[model samples]
Target: MSVIIRKSLLELIFSGAFMKRWNDKLRPMELVEVDKQGHKMIVAWLLFLLNSKGMDVARKRALGESIIEGGIYDYLYRLIITDIKPPVFYRIKENPDDYRTLSNWVLDQLKPRIMPLGEGFMRGMSEYLMQPEDKGLARRILNAAHLYASYSEFKLLKSINTMDHELTEIEDSFVSRLEALRDLKGVSELLNENDNVLGRFARMCGRLRYQKRWSQTPRVPETSVLGHMFIVASYSWFFSMEVGACRARCQNNFFSGLFHDLPELLTRDIISPVKGASQEIGDLIHEYENIELERVVLTPLRDGGYAEIADRLEYFLGLEVGSEFKATINRDGEVIEASDAKLAGEYNLDTLDPKDGPLLKVSDSIAAYIEAHTALKNGISSDQLHQALYRIQQTYKEKPVIAGVQVSALLADFD
Candidate 1:
């Protein structure tokens, strides 16, 4: 039963024309990239989670300031507009007052394309313990995330001269709208906090554009850490949905995918071969990454009263969680004892493990295969990429199933 659900969601994500736009073109950054919209959508979801944490603060501050009745909506609007492409973006910019018109128009274009998966994910999430209002909010955030994810790569292209002018204008427009809402109490503070956290994350993602993937291969467009994270998260979501993950489990998988490589933000992307050199060296690098993650990301969020956020990050990166191999599924297709079971169960699924930690591992491999396969299709010859594609193919050759879903079939679809 869960496999059927997962299969449908996976198909939906892949078949959506909106998502196809990203698949159709390589990312603008001089290197080949995969699934730009998919990546942005994942980040948008992350931002939504972060925003949810501070919603109480936001509501109190908004009421105190009395700037407008819908300050929170405005704030989200501003964050979302950053992902809108030109023409539509310019149309929105020109009318500003007609934001509703532009927003509606944009939705008209995207809702049919992406909303089914969005709604399905939400329904799957319904098994979690959240207020009805929160579920509604989550739906809205997911919708916005889906739209923004498709366009976010453009923002990263600003560093390249050819794309600088248009990207700058789009960014300027986003900034101007943000500034207009700066006067709302907590708005400025919240934006600053987001900038400190998410902004830094975004910039770190940009640096990945320059980091070459499969460096051993002949020339290939670089797959930055940022783009990789997005693909991982997107792939993870598909797997999670296939497994009939509850809202909390799905959220855990998605976020874990998004931040799995956050340590790379500080250390730069240390290639796998280097880490695989020796267990001692690999352990040392892992230790260093953990230390940096704690010092750079976790501790700061904890001090800022976002201990939950910090904990989530730790869990996603396998910092505090034990080995993922411990995760298992029951004959009934339910998670039995996942590494993150205790935490995942806190939100719901008290008797069943969420298995998100292990699921994320599978998604990570799938994303890697897609990267290599896409590169090969573009005629970039590389022994490493070809090897990677072969290794992944062989590894999952025998219908590798996880949490009751046949992941091999998912991978086979691409082949």
Candidate 2:
């Protein structure tokens, strides 16, 4: 199958917004799948940082892709197996025959919509879901991330649901599952340990759920910065696959998209309007974000013996290049900025550890368009959103292609 990103695939990614978690229990705030996936990926990254010390880039890429795909497979399966209690789901897993029968149904339902991603990707996803006994490190990392994110939500529920009969069991379940992974490099420190650097980092990432995008404008089913990051990451990976980017570039793009707005966690969601109002204002905000990002997040990680994470983050955020959206390649341990044309023509190779910054920028804009268009369709009306949708459409209207993908045409799907 040729690589393709169709409307169905995009919608499949966005459908997470409609799938609520903890629906069976009382919840203070709405817990949706997208936000949880976002949080899970962040935690997974932190875990990777912890355990992947001295790991080679190729192995790191493989681990990262596995985590990304595993999360996707879990999300798709859960979309079909909605609202099943955890114990019941675990019981179903224990019975291989029953679980296989159900998962096969899900794969069948998903086949058509997912096939456009190419046969290799479809195979990977199927293999991940069909095997009920994958206890590999990637699987463990994903499980730990899932538990960590779910525990975050459970903390909220415990505040108001003290009288609920299931509260104790739920709390015990979370503790047991997390404790099972204490042997992992960072899990022990992360378990209710606030001062640990990794713990503090993951907590800060979780706090992004409280930061809303387009904070000034009211929109239906409001989106958080955390959720938006995951959306962009997913889009970039899809586009990366379509463009035949190297394996390293694909992971780099996905993770770059994942953490591109991380500074916003410290600065809050500063809208583009304010950033673009004046060059001085933009530069000031940019400088402030970098200084704070390093002092608060990166420095602590490096000082705490996790320089790998900080280095990778700086590379992903393109700190030296001055913009995450700038195309770059590493040549013999030296970072070289490349033009979009140069990247496509001469540097689309895995050995370069390339990043398609131009393509990621496209993905970022496409995510923004989706957010605005979805809100407009959701019966919300505001001048800010209207102008935003119009602006994105107009900007892409004449640009027929980006990184070999027809991005302008992609936007037209919404119109």
Candidate 3:
């Protein structure tokens, strides 16, 4: 029963939309290639969090010296530089004071798209880890992350010029309407402060471009783990849209999918075959990931008093939950109790079931299928690729739906 549920969930995580993310080209280079930006942004955000010690120190100094909070300024700066789309950014650059107003407008547009998942994870931090006084700070950080995740895709879209000319023009005009506010005195002061942390983190994320995915697959374009996460997150958002998921559910699915492979940063991309080599081996790998994640990722943040950020990562990555498949099902195929229930009972009462585990599983499988499919299309014949494609298709042969998504139809589109 658990196997069935796990299988279904994997299928959702690898859904066609997720896979298509890999195919989405990014550029500004000689090579006609780049991995999806959505995944890259997830890694970027994680890096930002990991490298935020300097920012935290700066914020502390500001508070002690009776200076205004520099944290908010740092947040805005990072968001503008990292996630703000080119079309909108050009406008924001022209008028920095309107940054607050324009940012809200941009977020509104991104709400139905990819920001919700990041938003949910941010909100999770405030709810679970932070003190009341720090909740506002948590929210500001969330806004930054959310904005980055949303606009991250535009880097690729603009590079490839994928959208129609008319649509591009419309987007440009829409952002240009906001008049430039001349005075940015407060913002300017904040911006003048040192931002070594942000710079270091941004550079670290940039290195992911060199950390190629599917290293064994020949004749395939190089993909970075960073890019893959963005794609998965975006795909999860699209899948949520397709299934008419509630706002909260959509956020959960997007974030869960976005950070699903985060442990790979410390562990590298440990391929599935090695993980599935044996039950004991799989369990051991999982154990190692948990340990490394805590040591290399979560512990430093917690020690630095950014426990909220660490907690949010654990939640989104399923570290806190133990299993990616959150629901317990019996042989009769009824949910006995979901992981969320256990969480709510143990933690905050406001905690709600994300109901996205199954969807994430499907998205995962779809992503795998597309990777195999793309390899095959490139004439890179590998037994593993062929078998993976066949296995996924075979597994879903009679499975028509999971989490309200038409499984058969989704697979058929790939066919």
Candidate 4:
């Protein structure tokens, strides 16, 4: 089947309007046998499309000519290139009068391609669509979509291997550690399962990125939720040591950071602007989020051998069951309001005491500042870093723990 498809693909490319029409009417997989098992069908189709018409090639080549002649080819090919390709289709569709059945076809086909690009493209598109005067925004959107599609496919290849093991050696090691942690007395059941622990922790870390206010930072790298978790956990451990805290306290802090934003896996990283609107709007959003968190995040964790762990974590985070421990740690890491803070704070930390909470805070601040300073040394501005350090210092000024720490001096090292 594949051989036949490959042999005919060249003919199809040259078939012009016929091939375009066919692609417009049906999915590429239905028209051709190039869809290889385990290989992405989209990539195969893209290869076919690219071979026939190079990216943004004028629609007047032999293949385009054939598309005009072949009714079936003309139908689907137009649907794909126009609407499904991004920027081009979306731009035209903005004027509803310009939209046709063909336009709808383009949207349906491209959805599969665009969806995999995830939050970055979604955010980027939202911003791009609002730029009313930028005539070039359409082209930029197309470029962005193309780049996103390429990156998504590349990441998919990187994440899994032929051995069929989804987790790498490093990830496997981490899973083993989680399993061991689950076996310990008083360990939560949620962290016991191999998949659940990783999924929940990954989600939590992703959410913490927003809470830590990194999302608003422009040009953040294409980081996965799990990537953020590892960094935060590492920072938590380092700060624990600097404070000469107990090993157990430090371990708890690490875990706290690891699971701080688990609720976000369900709630998503709600951006600042949307969240900061009128009180009534904010309350309505929160209500919707509460229902979603319970239905999605909490329920699944409980059912997946981590119910007890989830319960304990919920208690620790003071969301519901363990609401008693609700607290806020100041910049230097002192618990100021355990109860009210839990209800209002962005990140949940139900079980964490002031010692654990503040240590994580300091670590979070220091890590961010250090990263900023490093970036500045590499030619990025240090204004944000300076502001952050000042804010952190001010927040912790009254605390004896941070007294004489000389954070300004430490930051100067990066400069």
Candidate 5:
């Protein structure tokens, strides 16, 4: 593809009428005219509004303001005026209610609108949005779409009825944290309340898989992070129960599994090569992430009045503030001897001990096998399947902890 096509596509992604015109695959010059011009005009108008001072000054000014300031304000303003197109602003000054519905309709129209973006762009966007001193119009866009609300707004909107509004001193505390996550934009899109707990749990599992390894796959059928979460959560629940675990453990494991990858919402899933770089490089990335989480995740949670929610999540993960370290504990308490019929043994605390480690490990492995198997079933080469099988078997062989179990057989059974 030419640079013009690439540039036009980038411009089209942010265009209001993009969906209407997208299938045409119009000429690069036409695309440039439509998308680029529209963006520039809209951004220019916003810059004039924000920084042009009085009306007389605004009208007389011929020269444009800085694109940076204007672009930022335009993005923020668009968020506040979600669904209300630039055209509507001209007509709705007199009818707020009609404009409100029109605005909502516009956003609803975009909800089903999906876009396929590269992992590089996705991660960049996440990092860009997660800054503490951040100013993102997209987040505001999400908020205006009613995908998110302040904690108080959520409380009012949800009518959360309960005698005890605050967390009891002895309660798990994570419950409050989970409650805080209730109103985040894109979160509900990711989680499900209509589905049974197992169903909801499954969604979380799918997300974890996507977070760890999205680029390895050629294409993501449903490209949103939320969609990926839903699938993984389902598989995790199914495999967990199949392994003879009880309902509660499975649910907790499933939830933990889902949330295990939540940070990726901010970090984006860093591929293995970039992540496995030199110690200094890795540490630098880690440090950058620490800064971002504090700015993006932590502060947002606080501003949203769900500080307790963030606190609980950190506690559950056994992590402290200002650090990205997460603890994943094994299921079945301590590591047990593979041959020991009693299945009891020493507890290993010197390593990662996240609550969902074992379950996530199993879920992750099963998902890989299932994905590869599905591909083969759909006519992926036998050679490809064999390669996947080799990797799966080797992984099981190396991970002595999981080798004792029947994970490979379970995946094969599914196949």
Candidate 6:
């Protein structure tokens, strides 16, 4: 099915950046919807990685699709409800007729904007939203991830809110809810263990929420590196559908976009201008990033028996093939680079475990452009933002198509 792609749809997804998480409580740093969603997805994937030891590709794909689609639905619903307390929302959900009415309204609002994602996506969203009692493994994983992400944020605020009575209650609630999921395959193993590998890795990703993007310039609804990654991941998924990417290619692109700047978690967000100062400086920074990435992320995962996870991450980052922006695939344990044309043609099979690196680059750039453009639209302009937008547009101006999508035309739509 052909789906329309437009500015409003992408902007709708980006709007999550402005939706503050835990609005009623005091936070050491701002916790926004985008960052929370990003962290949740990361945790979900981490849990999925370990728990899905013997699952078939089809089942994995279905569950993965559910996680992604369910997340989108959750975000959209949260946006409409606008800071309703969980208890109150639960009350609303308890009334089947009322819940159905409310959910349908949400789908109505989302349909026009998200219909472009395709009929199946909207159908999944509607079905998932209307049926609130989904007890599948995918749902369990999402539930576990949700509590983990929220609990991680609670830790950040716990230091300052030590005396607040409600803080203790919230903490207990999070623990109880998470403990309830101990029945789930990997939840107990990881969460029950002290300073376990998955816990450490998830916490590392949570820290990305603190690393703000565009550090050199101020912008309205400031986005963190974590939030930016989520946007890129989201865009990559939608674009993958738009271009008819294979299952593995779509999965690879989404995850690659998700973790593209993960190295920045250690080094912080390095502005492009500083990196672009000289070729040597850029190379030095790249070299340093790889060193730190291996030492901190890969080494720990490998040591903890999550080497497959580590290796897959390395592949997504294109550690062996060069820049993460280069198209590549894994065939019988060998990392082979390919062109966008080949990815769309010969290497589209799932067994190749292909990743569309160039398409992922386009997703990354378009996400940045949207960030700058949104900031300007929100009336918090700076030369940095303007220059960033201009540079992206100029870069794509001569290229009408990129990774099977109309890159120049899409950029022109924003004009």
Best by lDDT: 2
Across residues 177-235, which tens digit of lDDT does each residue of candidate 3 receive? Answer: 21121021111111221343332233334344445567776535445666566445655
Model 6 local distance difference test score: 0.85
- Per-candidate TM-scores read 0.63, 0.96, 0.54, 0.39, 0.39, 0.96
Instruction: Please give the CA lDDT of all the candidate structures.
Output: 0.51, 0.86, 0.49, 0.38, 0.37, 0.85
Screening candidate 2 with a backbone cut-off below 3 angstroms (N, C-alpha, C), the clashing residue pairs are none
RMSD of each: 8.8, 1.5, 12.7, 24.3, 21.7, 1.5
Q: In model 2, which regions exceed 4 Å deviation?
A: none
Q: How many residue pairs clash in each candidate at the backbone level?
A: 7, 0, 27, 39, 18, 0
**What tens digits encode model 4's per-residue C-alpha lDDT throughout 143-163?**
222232222222334433335
Residues 302-378 of candidate 1: C-alpha lDDT, one tens digit per residue: 77665766765665665544433234332254334544444334433513324466577777777677667667777
Better of 5 and 6 by TM-score: 6
**Colliding pairs, model 6:** none
Clashes of 1: 7
Q: Give the local distance difference test score of model 4.
A: 0.38
Please report how far candidate 3 places residue 112 from its true position, in Å.
19
